[model samples]
Target chain A: MTTSQNRSAFLSGMLAMLPVTPGIIPFAMISGMAALDAGMSPLTAQLYSVFVFAGASQIAAAQLITSHAEPLVIILTIWIINLRFVMYSASMSSKLPPSSIPKALQAYVMTDQSFAICAGMFDQNQVPYENRAMFYLGSSVIMWLIWQMATGVGIAFGSIIPTSWSLDFGVWLCFIAIMIPGLKDFPAIIAALVGGSLALALHGLPFNLGLVIASVVGIACGYLTEKKLSSNLPVKSDNDAKERFQ
Target chain B: MSLPTLWFVILAGSLGTFLARYSFFWLSGRKALPEEWIRILRFVPPAVLAALIVPGVIAPGLETENPLFNPRIIAALIAITIAWKSKNVMATFAFGMGALWLLQYVETLL
Candidate 1:
């Protein structure tokens, strides 16, 4: 691609993600507030936004921090939560140009929003493979900048807000917002129910291991349920079910 | 956690997350991930969120004696309803926080 074409593609990618900014603002703000409530310094909170970049995991990590969970457990939880990115990466690998973009840059910029935008573009053949890197860079860079700035503003705003306001509730609200959307299928619903129940039952586990155990059990139950359901179905209908699950 | 420990967690977490993101691209020449693995991974998001949110709602603190009939649980139910109906994050936040504040207020009144 020529320089101007690359620039335009990048610009267009940024514009495409513009509408998502409004939704992201509240999330970034809540994350900042939660970090502060979790006893993180403003710098560390901002750094969390910079390094973690994933909202849900950051919130989970902040909650763990507040409870004084061990660092290893915190890291493991965040990693487990982020394993979805591997799926995103796999899906994007075929669409991204093989030889041009460095793996590091691609990995650094990989995010749910950018991947969604790029995946749509790939589906439409809107951008050529050569320009996919520029497109992704544009989209992800804009998102990254906005998230950082939003988190910074939130941290500043959070520090001034009195504890009487009880903004900490925003964190759990954010989690609820995220979780409700993913309850689309039977397996997903079962997974959530099992996970939630186990989390509650094992809430007294030392070092906050209950959350980890619950997550494992939930995923296992969901996977097994999906497997059993798929196995019992006829061949043609099984394919349809698999597609729906995907 | 100490400052160093916090930094270590952030760094280690970032590294692990990045590896997950980089896996397919870095190993493009290798065999693809199994279909079963992909299907299983689909459950991770909801499951993880559930595990996290359940405790936050039912037993926010380790010392909480009662897990039910709390402000957080009530507010969370309201938030879930809004989210399910509207799928709007902002709406969920508004309703959830409003319900929480109102519940706390009523508790104080009684």
Candidate 2:
């Protein structure tokens, strides 16, 4: 594709991702504020946001630190929360064509929001396969910028925001919005139900270890459900032009 | 929380996360995973998201003396409906927060 075409594909990616930006704003701000509340210096909080770059995991780590959990425990908890990234990374590998960009840089920028958005675009053929990586960059790079800016603002001014406002709850609301619509197939629905139920049952586990066990059990349920039950939902043949963004 | 420990958490956590994100790409020379792996990975987002969100929404109710009814759970139910109907982020967020605040107000009156 021409450079002009590449530019537009990138722009389309950014536009598609625009609607989802609001979801992360609360999350980034909350994560930033949580770090500060946990007694990390501004520099440390900012650096944590930048380097860790995963909102849920960053917040989880900060909470662990506050309880004076062992450093190894903190790291492992972060890994467990982020374990889905292994799936995301594997899935993303297929979507992204071979590129000149270093593998490390690509991995660092791969986020749940950008990955979900771009994957939907690719599946719908909204953008050319040739430009998949470019579209990904368009979606991811902007997300990274926004997350950092929001985190910095959160660190700088998040203290002023009243806790009673319950802004942190918005993150869960965002995830719900993204997740429910994707419950198209039987396996997907089963996965969600099993995962949700297991999580609640295991809620009292220490260090959020319940999440780890629940996710594994949930995914297994989904896989087994798919194998046992053929999808009854009729397959659509690219007729619906719904732009399933974030 | 010590200087050394703090730095270790950040640096080591970042490295571990990077590995999680990079695991597949670093291992695979091909463009995609085997079809079997793809089938399994498809559920990753759905399952993981469910794991993350469900417990979070219920926690407010769980924490209170009454596990059956709470502002957060009610608000989330409203948000779930909004999300299913419109699939719009702003709509869900707005309605969810609105419901929560309204319920909290009613609770105050009660």
Chain A TM per prediction: 0.87, 0.78
For the predicted complex of model 2, DockQ is 0.56
lDDT of 2 by residue, A1-246 (tens): 688978887787787778789877867887898799778999999999999999877876786688676678688767766766776777677677887667787889988778777777787787778888778888888999999999999999988888888876776786787677767778878988998999889878876777678878888998788878864433221111123343
Worst ten in a row by lDDT for model 2 chain A: A235-244
- For model 1, state the Cα shift of residue B20 in Å: 1.0
- Compute each candidate's TM-score over C-alphas: 0.89, 0.83
User: How large is the interface RMSD of candidate 1?
Assistant: 3.6
Candidate 2: the clashing residue pairs are: none
Let me know the DockQ for model 1: 0.59
Clashing pairs for predicted structure model 1, backbone only: none
- Scored by TM-score, the top model is 1
